[model samples]
Target: MKLAVLATGNIANKVTQTLVQIKELECYAVASRELSKAQQFKERFGFKKAYGSYEEMVCDPEVELVYITSPHSHHFEHMKLCIEHGKNVICEKAFTVNAAQAREIKSLAQEHKVFVTEAIWTRYMPSRSIINKVLSDGLIGDVKAITANLCYNVCHRNRVSNPTLAGGALLDVGVYCINFALMHLGSDIREIHSTWQKIDTGVDGMNTISIQYNDGRLANLTSAITAKSDRQGIVYGTKGYMVITNINNPSLIRVFDYDDKLIKSVEVPPQISGYEYEFIESVKAIGEGRIESWSMPLTDSIEVMTIMDQIRAQWGLRYPME
Candidate 1:
């Protein structure tokens, strides 16, 4: 599969390194607004070609898949470009600025018969199923609550502080906490409440969200771009609790009883930066002529975005793009 990356940013660099490690996918092309930056990325990642603009890259006949690593606010526009060109897309998380844009792109992809999916990565990781199995096997007994926190000191970055770019902790990292809760606790949310602190840019800098599911389960989630956190996710149950060391890229899962006694620890399978799974899955879906990955379906993406929209609405926060 020939993969074209849409940006020359840090994430594009990281994901490209992992793409080269996969035998089936080729880092065929890269694109940036400036030709020189694209050329630099091409040389650094050994891409077969580099284009000065995304328009040029997507027009390539050999580019079957376009991985969009652009900013959150630009995802809708970039994805539309790819789908319009009849190219499959693997868009980064926070799929769009809002649920409206998400629905539009989803409809466009289906109309074009192009395989478009969100690159939420965690949904495709091996740890997802491993944790599911542990829960289903009665090891954790009856699941009740979930707690996840993901934070980093990223306020210094322009993309993290600019509302025009959909800058915020919720869309950037808080989405992971929401994804974590939905993945394990299910999304039949009964009630939602949150408190958020905004930065000078008018985007959320820190947020604490609480969700109540129809099953009476509760989730306490927090995300911040102004500070650092332990980045842990815990699934609490009647009998025991499971701890996921890093909700973003789970490397280890630990289980403990109500007495706080250690029960078991499981290490995730070795990975090539933990991004190969999503790309591999996207390639497989495209090969099978599927418009979405079974793991991270378009509906799931829409649901997650809708949840974020509701959260933002509650906080009276709206991005400039929206």
Candidate 2:
């Protein structure tokens, strides 16, 4: 798989580094609006090619996959360019600014017979897989409830408080909370109630989402840029509970039986920030002629976006040109 990453920023760097780690995939090139940035990245990552424009990179037949690592507001445009050019895409989340944009991209990708997914690396990580196995084994019995807290002291990232950029904790940091709940509990987000701490840009500096399911299962999920919470999550059930420490990054998962007895802690590590898994998955799915990923389908991405959109609407958070 030959992959070209759009935007030579932080995430683009991560994507390229991870792509190189895959045995079959090559980080063919990197492109950014700034030509110097792309050139610098090529030297730093050893990618053979670099482009100042995404369109120019996508036109190359050698590029089998295109990773859109642009800003949240620019995902739709970047994805459209890649899909229209007949390139598969691994997009960064909030997939798009809203669910409506996600729908548009999905339709285009399907019509083109191309694969597309929110390059939400965490969902495709080994830690998530390990936990899935534990849950399927009934180690936690029937999942009764879930609590996730993801708050960090991102004082340097004013994007959370920048209205012009749609920088909020919900889209940037909180997306993981929503994805974790949806993965463990399934795609049924019946109702969501969210409250936020106001940022300088009138967006949420910190927000907590309460998701209720049909089976009386509820998840208390929270995301913030104000201060660090436990940065951990718990899935509880009648039989046992699973504890996920350092939920935001790659880490270990510990399962406990009743009376808070430790069942086991799976030590799955040596993963590079866990972002590499999603890119590799996209390559496999596309190679198999699949239009969507079974692990995290386009519909699943839209469902998560729908929940995020509703949460934003309830909090009076609106992004520009959305």
Q: Give the candidate number with the greatest lDDT.
A: 1
RMSD of every candidate to native, in Å, equals 0.8, 1.5
Q: What lDDT tens digits, residue by residue, belong to model 1 across residues 1-322?
A: 9999999898898888899899879889999999999999999989999999999998899999999999999999999999999999999998999999999999999899999999999999999989988998888899999999999999989987789999899999999999999999888999999999989889999999999999899999999999999999999999999999999999999999989998989999989899999999999989999999989999899999999999999999998666
TM-score quality measure for candidate 1 = 0.99
Q: Total clashing residue pairs per candidate? A: 0, 0
Cα error, candidate 2, residue 243 (Å): 0.2
* TM-score, structure 2 vs. true: 0.95
Residue lDDT tens for model 2, 181-261: 888888675788889998666778888899999888999988888788888889998898999987777487999989898
